[model samples]
Target: MAKLVDLTKKPYNLNADQIKWVEDTIAGMTDEEKVGQLFVNLFFPGSDEYSGNEFTNQEIVEKFHIGGARYKGQDSVQVQGLLNELQSASKIPLLVAANCDSGGDGATNDGTYIASGAQAEASGDTSVAYNAGYVSGREATALGVNTNFDPCVDILMNWRNTIVNTRAYGTNADSVIKYTNAYLEGLTQSEIIQCIKHWPGDGTEERDQHLVLGVNELSVDEWEDSFGRVYRNHIENGVEMIMAGHIALPEYQKALNPSLKDEDIMPATLAPELIQDLLKTKLDFNGMVITDAAHMLGMTSAMRREDYVPLSIAAGCDMFLFFNDIEEDTMFMMNGYKNGVITEERMTDALRRILGLKAKLNLHLKQAEGTLLKDKSELEVIGCEEHLEMGADAANKGITL
Candidate 1:
């Protein structure tokens, strides 16, 4: 049997009862439930139809028992209503997440559109970053979302990097670190889980991962001083989650193992050296590692879905980001487990981290209390005057002379 992770550890910090609950819950989960925990499906707000996929969010939960979901931004009332239904449908509490990098409006329709990353970088003030996280966390959580994917830490080194240019703070490591730390502080105060994204760094390449396979071409020492510096600081500061991107850091991979051919170098999401050795072992991140969306060509082009789907989980990513097709992907995952692509040990480790995150969020307690969704009164904070004013001030300060 795989060794059980100590739930009372730093990131999780679950008490004895909470630990027991997490263990007991894991022990009781069926095989389907276990596999489902490895996926975080994407859903749209307006309709049951999305991207030609007809399955409703409820169907995903009922059929696959998915552990988490990411939803598009909508008005507070509509967002909350749909989330409540998904929460009620699942046996386990779902980790509802939103892309709050721009601000709370990234999650909720009426939320404050605080400074963009470029704006925040231009302002050159860490407090702007802090409020971006604080205000985003406040509005997002008030609408029942538990995870915030913000403070895109990619260094804007290549000016041609359009995808992450406006989403990043700046080109300096010290500046990125300072702003990221401040953002973490602000998000923590609002009591929401923070997940830093595009791991092993981005912006070194001008290509978008969505359209092509992106690579971070820095040498080992160069990366260590730059992107490595940023990640090391965040990991040390107790960031609870990371989103592994499809970008590759081949130099580091080769340094870890000289045998790895150039063709064998995969994106961080599908690379054991990057995810397991570099991120988990070297960096010592105990938090959950999720893939950046699964459907992106950055990932899909690497290999067939059947191979990469399970390979993502096997590579140490605890959760796959989105589904190509619910049934087909689930079948691929199950087949991987059955065919031995995803070993039992790897599966257990992924489950432990996934459940550990949920437990850390106190989902178990809220599930029992039937209080997953806050009342509509909390919606008042969505675009409150105070937040709007702060956002406007931040925006003006970010304008370059």
Candidate 2:
């Protein structure tokens, strides 16, 4: 096993009180609760009357005790109210997250729409990337969202990669590193937990992980020169979390353990050799490792639903993203722990990391004070003139053609 980082240190930065809180909180949790902390379910935008999804959302919170939620495009006030309700419903404070890949607009329709990574790079000013992150963080934080799954650091080397075309920074590692770090800097300054993503890199493969498993065919040396270098830089710089992609790297898998058969190769989301051996052990990424959405074909096609949840935790993933059936998945995890498929030690480790992230964001502290969003004035900053100008300025300077 890779030596786990001292949880109370730098990146996590838990004080003695916070440490005790996390420990006590974990100790108080039931197996079901602990398993619930390992998921970040999708939050549809609307109230009970309007969307009818609110009841299910409440059930996910009250029953499953979900750790976090991801929201995309909703009325700012309604979204905030929904999040507050969800947070209030949970015993532990929820770590609200969003697909703020491009900017805050990725999460909400009212948010500033900044230039995409490719567009940002075209301006030839890394500061635009920083501005993008800042705007994303500022707006997301204003709306009570603490996590942004963004700064897509993938090197778009494949011309045929449709999904990553404008999403990625650029084709080269140097540019990706520069822009990614700048973007992270902006997010960090705004106090939004940034998740650098699509680990082992994407865009080298033409296939999308949502439909089928993709492969980044780089050999060990090539990966180290490109994607490896970028990821290590972020990890060393104390990135809070990483989203492991559904893609696979056969070369790295073969290099790590040559005995593996062709059928054994699996998406990084379910591959212990990839997630545990490669990312945690070899890469020494002690921070949280969240899987890409389990509902995707890349994951579902590779492994059965019941097997993926427990196996993902056992394979060193701290959280599973999305859900096909929230209640069913939650039950599967609870049973996994009871059946000894997911060990207590493993469950504890996952909970510790999950709570540590919550602690890092001081969600526990916020929950205690009942001050998730201080005042509506914070919401006023969303899509304000200054932010829109920043987005427009970035586009004016960054867009190539």
Tens digit of per-residue lDDT, candidate 2, span 1-401: 63454587646877888888889999898777888888887877673421333346677788778898886568788777778778878888888888776677876788888778998789888888888888888888887888888888899999789878889998989999998888888878787777888987898979988899878999999999999999888888988888989888989998998998879988888777887788777877778888987877888888778888888888778899876766678778887888888787788888888889888878877777868654677889888898888888887897466
Compute each candidate's TM-score over C-alphas: 0.97, 0.96
Model 1: pairs clashing at backbone N, Cα or C within 3 Å: none
Which digits, one per residue and each the tens of the lDDT, describe model 1 over residues 1-401?
Answer: 22334457767788877777777988998889989988888777766755666777778788899999888866889998888888988898888888888678888878898877788778888788888888889888888889887778899899899778888888879878888787778778776788997998898989889998889999999999999999998888888889999999999999987999999989999998888888888887888889999988999999999999999987889899888888889889999998888998888888878888888888989989978767889889888998888798897888887
Residue 65 error, candidate 2, Å: 0.7
Q: Listing every candidate in turn, what is its Cα RMSD in Å to the true structure after a full C-alpha superposition?
A: 1.7, 1.9
TM-score of 2: 0.96
**TM-score of the candidate numbered 1?**
0.97
Lowest-scoring 10 consecutive residues by lDDT in candidate 2? 47-56
Q: Number of clashing pairs, model 2?
A: 1
Residue 198, candidate 1: Cα error in Å is: 0.8
Error of 2 at 225 (Å): 0.6
